[model samples]
Target: MKLATISVGGRPTPAVALGSGRFVDLSREGGLPSTLLGLVRGWDAHRGAVERLVAAGTAEIGPEGVRVLAPIPRPERNIMCVGKNYYDHAHEFHGSGFDSSGGAQAVPEVPVIFTKAPSAVIGPGEPIPAWRDPTGTLDYEVELAVVIGRGGSGISKADAYGHVFGYTILNDATARALQRKHQQWFLGKSIDGFCPMGPAIVTADEIPDVAAMRVSTRVNGELRQDARVADLIFDIPTLIETISALVTLEPGDIIATGTPAGVGLGFDPPKYLKPGDVVTLEITGLGTLENPVGGRPA
Candidate 1:
């Protein structure tokens, strides 16, 4: 099931997609959780009811007045992010001269983990605040973001898939100069409106093979980054095991598996984002997330 958070009557409502741009407001149906996070928390108990509602298909509304929001509008904690998890992106980043998390090695021995503040998240169709980068080096990284369902620590690679709830697209937008200056990722990656995610969350059950999925990004109309999830240097299970070993994973917790090569910095003459540019990121099975660059100076 594709679940989403939408606006109806000026209030956020949990909804299920009926496809072709229609949604069933789960909130209007009494006895179910009121938010997407709540539903995810109690999925085992609520799955049948949600399934029944979708089957019933009553009061299904069109996309006319409803506005789709990020499946998790505001995350409870900082978002877990892996840097340079793709071999190509790792090498490109190393050669770009902006990588400060050193080691002459292009590929890390283990996952390079970091966090993006919860405040940075914005939903589909919102503008990316490129103006916040004083150095004018706003760049984009389209990544496959995992939404954790079951909470746990000491999770093994073998048990990782069992804890996954669903999947979504996340744009790990960054400021190149900030990244270079701090010699760390948090400050550069935590800028408000830098994290753009979701059109909807497609439950893990819908995806038979996560590795077969293709994730790509387009700036305006040009395809910039295109790669298979199978290409991840550090796959999902490894990342899950690595992070959960230290920090507990909980329902609604998000981990953005790092992006692939072709980020602006990877180019000879970097193509940093400016006001009016549109970035569209798409992951197979998970819907596309598109946002415009905004906050232009006069």
Candidate 2:
């Protein structure tokens, strides 16, 4: 089922789409477990509860005019992102001074992970603030984000899918110049309002072929990135197993599967984002996320 979080009467609530622009209210079913983090921690139970609510008509179908929030607002921790997980992406950045060879080598023995602070997250249709730094070179990376269903440590690749509650679209926004200056990715990636996620979270059951989905990004209505998840060098199962071996994967924990080629940084002069640009990211089976760009507040 397609699930979402939306603002009703100025309050955020859980909802499920019922097609034809109708949605079922999940609030009436004991409300949406406080926040998205809570729901993730108790995803199995929550999913069951939501299903029951819909079946019994305890939840009412509402109009489509309501405002929607990120499927999970205020996730429990910073988002975990994989970098250079696609062969082409790795090749593109291999010898660019960021990494040796500009990224044209085989996949790494282990997943290359990074974190984007929770503060960077914004809901669908939200505005992303452009950093005030004159050297800021904002860029976008469209990815398929996996949401952990249950908390676990030492998860095995064979059983990793069991820990996944669902999936959503993620835009791994970055400050390219700052990234190079700091000599690390976190500072450039952790800026507030940089991560745009949501549109909705599709339950794992609804998506049978997570690896085959088509993903793409557009800036100001122009296509910038496009690729299939099947091209991922490490894939989701391996990532979950590898990451869980290092740290406990908790509910609400997001793992961005990495972006495909065609980022601005790949361009000779680079095509960084500027104030007033609109970005739209879409993954087949998942939904579309759109956000506008503006200067950071003083």
Candidate 3:
């Protein structure tokens, strides 16, 4: 089932998509969880509620007066992001020289990990505000975001997929100049509204096999990045097992599984984002997440 958080009557409501830009307010269902975070925290118990709501065709509403919010509007903590997890992107990032990889362009033996502040995430259709820094040089990384449903540590790669609840599309927007200056990614990547995610989150049942999916991004009307999710050097299960080995993965915790080659910096002279540019990121099972560039003084 496709799930979302939306605004209705000035209140945030957990929802299930009813197709054709419409949604059913799961919040109104007696005993149902009130938010996406709440639902995920008790996903095992509430999965049946969401499925029943969709199957019953109840509380259907159109998008006209509603605002679709990120599935997890405010994450419990920072977003777990895998950096340079794709072979071509690893080389391109190394070649760009802004990479914190010490100019290393080879595929990593383990996943290159980074954390993007949860505050950076904005819902689909929101503007990706430009940074005030000179060289603005903003870029986009289209990724498949994994949302964990159960809490666990020491999870094995064989059991990783079982811990996942669903997936969403995410755009890891960055300030290339800041990336090089800070010598680390947090500041450059955590700028407010830099992570544009969701139209909706498709449950794992809808996508029993994720590796076969395709991930692609477009700037305005032009295609900028494209790759198969199967190409991930450190695939989802490995990523989960790797991260869980250190920190416990909890319900609603998100992990952006890195981008493929063809980010703005992968171009000759680097085709960075400009005000008014619209970027759209799409993954096969998850819907498209599109955001327009916002005007910011250079």
Candidate 4:
């Protein structure tokens, strides 16, 4: 089932997608957690109930009736991110002169991990703070982020899939100059409203073969990035195993599994984002996450 968090009567509420751009307001039902994070933390115990509710649900809101927010609007912590996990993107970034992760190896021997501040997250249709970038070199990285359902340390790659709750699209918006100047990703990638996520989180069960799913990004009307999950150099299992070995991943923790080639930095002159540009990211069943470039929030 596709799970989501949406605005209902001005409140962020847990919901189940009924498709055709409609949702069942799960908030009205008692005994369920109030927030998407709470629901996910108790997912195993609440899964059966949520499933039944969806099965019997009648669509309560249409796409035009309410606003869709990020699946987990405020993740409990910074989002864990993998850098240069795609072969072509690795080569493109390495050659682009923005990569400062050290070494001449375009593709790393292990997952290149970093974290984006939780405050950076914004939901669908929200404006990306392109003006706040300071460096004026805004760029977009469309990624597939895994939502952890079960939390544990030292998880084996073999047991990784079992720990995933669902999937969502994440735009790892970056300030290219800041990224290179800082010599690390966190500062450049963590500007407020830099991360645009959601539309919905399609549960793991709904996605039969994740490797077959494709992810892409379009700036305005031009396609910029396109690749399949199978193109991932580290893959999901390896990422989980690699990160979990050091930090204890918790329920609702998000791991943005890097982006494919075609980022602006890959271009000769670099096609950075302007104030009026629109970025649209889509991943098969996860739906589209589109955001516009604009000045600071009012």
TM-score of every model versus the real structure? 0.98, 0.91, 0.96, 0.97
Q: Which lDDT tens digits does candidate 1 get at residues 1-298?
A: 8999999977998999777889999986788988899999999999999888888888589988898998999999899999989999999999999999888998999999999999999999999999888999999999999999998999999999999999999999999999999999999999999999999989999999999999999999899999999999999999999999999999999999999999999988999988999999999999789999998647
Point out where model 3 deviates above 4 Å.
103-105, 132-134
Best by TM-score: 1
Count the clashes in each prediction.
0, 11, 0, 0
Q: Report the C-alpha lDDT of model 3 over 1-298, residue by residue, as the tens digit.
A: 8899898878998998767889998876899877889988988887787778777886888878899888888898899999888899988988877877563446777888889998998998888888543568899999999999887999999999999989999888999888889898888889888888898888888996799999999998899888999999999999999999999988899999999999999999899999899998889978788889988645
Q: How well does model 1 score by local distance difference test?
A: 0.93
Local distance difference test scores for all models: 0.93, 0.83, 0.88, 0.92
Ranked by TM-score from best down, the candidates are: 1, 4, 3, 2
The residue pairs in collision within model 4 are none
Candidate 4's TM-score reads 0.97
Error of 4 at 179 (Å): 0.7
- Quality of model 2 by C-alpha lDDT: 0.83
Report the poorest 10 consecutive residues by lDDT, candidate 3: 99-108
